[model samples]
Target: MNHDSYDDNYIRGILNGVKSIAMVGASPVNVRPSYFAFKYLAQRGYDMIPVNPGHVGKSLLGKPFVASLSDIGRPVDMIDIFRNSSHIMPVVDEALTLSPLPKVIWMQLGARDDAAAERAEAAGLKVVMNRCPKIEYGRLSSEISWMGVNSRTLSSKRAPIPTQGMRLSLNRTSVGGGATTASDRAAKNRSEPT
Candidate 1:
């Protein structure tokens, strides 16, 4: 598959299908993009695991941070990398060693390694480079458009809800693998400042 320009369907599929994600190079600081991404994905229903050597045994959003992917001790459906381009290959190598290899290897924005991507794809894993899943999710789900961000998808009709009683559905269950009940949305609304 060409990594240069990915079709919307391919990105949507990965974001929809994956259940759990192990975020390599995650940071504890809230201001960092990775940290914001971690919080956002978790809010959107994906089980976001943080993997960072410095914060091993610590917690992020109530999920324990592991030193490495191998330390996760379970199958991770995807690996979202936040490291520099030059460091991607070793992370790919480590991802390959997992018992149930992740279905996808996603390199964060500004991070790309063609050789590593080729290697992972050769091993049968779907690869995405220089993209952020959180951004893709918001784009595909029309969240960005709703926020007036000019998502670039023009349609006369409002985007259809993926399911009944759901306003934005990206194919994953709400935050905890459950529907985004009215109360949940209400609480989120209350928490955000006016």
Candidate 2:
């Protein structure tokens, strides 16, 4: 099926079922989007393995940081990439080699490599590019407030906050940004034609 056919509901289902995720390029700095995204996922009860060579042997959000996907020595439901386009291939390659293979390879916003994504898709893995799983989750599940400005107002005389920010806005209600929000990431499990 075409990429456009894989809608928010489908992605959300996948996210809901995933129990663990390998966060490639996860950073120790809390200010980084990846760090917060990983933290958010962890808070939501998903096991998050931080993958960063420099931070190997350390931990983020209490999960050990591995140098690579294989270093995790266990099955990972997904590989959530936070690296740049230029650095994504190796991660995809490694993810492809995993025994069970990852159910999904999610490229964070501003990070897309057509070749790498094609490889993953060709290997029978679900691939999402340039979309934040977190944003979609919030919108599809009504976890975040998306009521836009109208004659009605939540507070007296104040305008509604437009769902715009570091996250890419989809459908005027769903906002995706930074490393993709936890809610958006959870949206990755929706079942549709892939």
Candidate 3:
């Protein structure tokens, strides 16, 4: 996988597949980008575990913070690294220690370590560098358009109105349209037979 530029499916697949995330360098401060990202993912129904040595015993969005990835005590589908480029390798090395390795190692915006990414990929983990999952999720789900940004996702069909909040669906025929909010999907699930 090209860590420099990721295909939409590559990102979408990772986002859709990952059920739980251990966010390293997560902050308790509400204004921090990591906090915002964590909150958004939690609201979207992803199990978010906060990891930060300094903030251990505290909580971010009510999720208790662990000192490190090893302390999570549960399997996480992805490791979202919120630290700077220089700190990425240590985090990646630590994440690699888990028995069932995470499916992805995602470096936040402005954070990139080619060596670290290469190692993770060689270990059979997908890698994303210098990108923010929050922003990508918003853009890919067309929720960013609500913020007046041109999401570059155009469609002739109208998007399904969200049932609550500003949440949109990751399942789509294209990037912008098809599936609606999570609540709507849940309603459909409740109505359908197994």
Candidate 4:
């Protein structure tokens, strides 16, 4: 079986076109990857609908957690899956069964379902398997600092030196008022030696 390369324009178009996302298996826990990715998308203006059977009726990031796709009344532009590959077929089936099919079906990193993706593609939906949308967005837009390396744009002024186990403090003085804000103090603490 031959796998085709993912088109850059196709990926970009799906990313730009998506407005609302139904995140399946979204956990309320912040330590989870799904939680962070969900928060990131929500912060970036995507309407996030968390889907978790165990957490139904609970609120995550100010949005209610739904048990299943069928429970959601509003239109879903995309279904970003965080579930395992074994359980993905049913989710794809449900998404495709909707009156208006979702624009995209994105499988999280390390989660790949070729059959489900093929079904989605056959149903005229854009399929992204084994890809993290949040990572893609940051990478494509150059928002990823790579620990302040690689690109010499805004982060070229000062290089991040290896301090090993050493602690540093940063200081900043406010203009006109001569008072420093909390952020300024924090920044100063980060750059100065303890």
Candidate 5:
């Protein structure tokens, strides 16, 4: 529960477990951080809901925007807060009101509210502060290394470029920076010298 540095397993567990997410303060503008993060998660196969009172009529990545978390109409596994620290409490408060409360509350980069994190944790929700799930997902999947960022992992066996292209998955081996399916690992093992 150290808000300063998160263990990778803690993040990976949440990322791998959560299938649906509600992103509050999402922006449809492609230049905005929220836009790409939303796109990234959606691409990874998470059901992404965009929430912003200002853009209720618009859609991003084919998902309609809702005015608030309360309007999502479907249960989301996590609530990702893109709002400023000062505005986080209200979002956390609203999340606590959901019938089947979300399992996690994730505050994006540069956005943290210790008080909000505390309350959500009290309500049995896992709390992550000032971290972007997109970044976490990429780092855990070694997708960040594809962008030339060092992932601090090295391995003798490299993964094959999937015929489907570079879609990231949390299940990938962190060392190789490529998607590694069970069959891919089997192929690798078969090719290695005895």
Candidate 6:
């Protein structure tokens, strides 16, 4: 449970387990890392809820943005923090107020708060600090290796690429809860008027 270093299995477990994620500090600007991460995770099948006070009532990736974590009506398996290190404590405080309480607290790259992490862990939430879920997912699933990026996973056989192209398929069986598969969601999106 060290905040400084996390095992691959621990990171993989979180990326695989969470079905729905409430992304705090999500941005509407495409240039921001949060925006890219939000889009990437959504495309991969996880139901992503955007939580940003300024963008409340706006839509991101087809999902309405909420003012806070409590505004989300359903249970969120993970709360991905994209805020500054100094802001993490309040974010963690807000996450703890949820009814079911998120299963995990993930702090994005360059965002770290040992004190906040400790508080979240003490409250029984699995904590992953200073790691980006998008990066971890790509690395663990071998999707990045296909992009000629070093995913750091070694294997003789290449991971199967989706016939549709570079789009990665969601591991529906590995997804926790009864969340809808990414394929199904993509199909729905396509069938919609857009």
Which one is best on TM-score?
Answer: 3
What candidate 1 gets wrong by more than 4 Å, as runs, is: 154-167, 171-194
TM-score, predicted candidate 6 vs. hidden true structure: 0.81
Q: What is the TM-score of each candidate against the true structure?
A: 0.81, 0.72, 0.84, 0.73, 0.83, 0.81
lDDT of 6 at 43: 78
Span of ten consecutive residues with least summed lDDT in model 3: 175-184
Write model 5 residue lDDT over 93-190, tens digit each, in one string.
99999988999999998777888899999989999977788888877777777799655445455655533224455554444333335534654464
Error of 1 at 47 (Å): 0.7
In candidate 6, which residue ranges exceed 4 Å CA deviation?
163-194
Which pairs, if any, clash in model 1? Answer: none
Expressed as tens digits, the lDDT of each residue in 101-188 for candidate 2 is 8899999876767789889989998887766556544444443445542211122233334342222222232233122444244444
Report the poorest 10 consecutive residues by lDDT, candidate 6. 170-179
The 10-residue segment of model 1 with minimum total lDDT is 171-180
RMSD to native, candidate 4: 15.1
lDDT of 6 by residue, 11-47 (tens): 7678778899999999999999999999988878788
Q: Residue 1 lDDT in model 4?
A: 20
> What C-alpha lDDT values do all the predictions have?
0.81, 0.69, 0.81, 0.72, 0.81, 0.79
Badly placed stretches (over 4 Å) of model 3 are 163-167, 171-194
**Model 2 TM-score, all chains together:** 0.72
Worst 10 residues of 5 by lDDT: 174-183
lDDT winner, 4 or 6: 6
Tell me how many residue pairs clash in candidate 2: 25
Residue-wise lDDT of candidate 4 within 1-194, one digit each (tens)? 22233444455577778888999999999999999998877876778899999998798989999999988987899999998889899999999988778889998876777898889889898888766887765433334446552211222234345243221111111122211255345544543556
What total of clashing residue pairs does each candidate reach? 0, 25, 0, 11, 0, 0
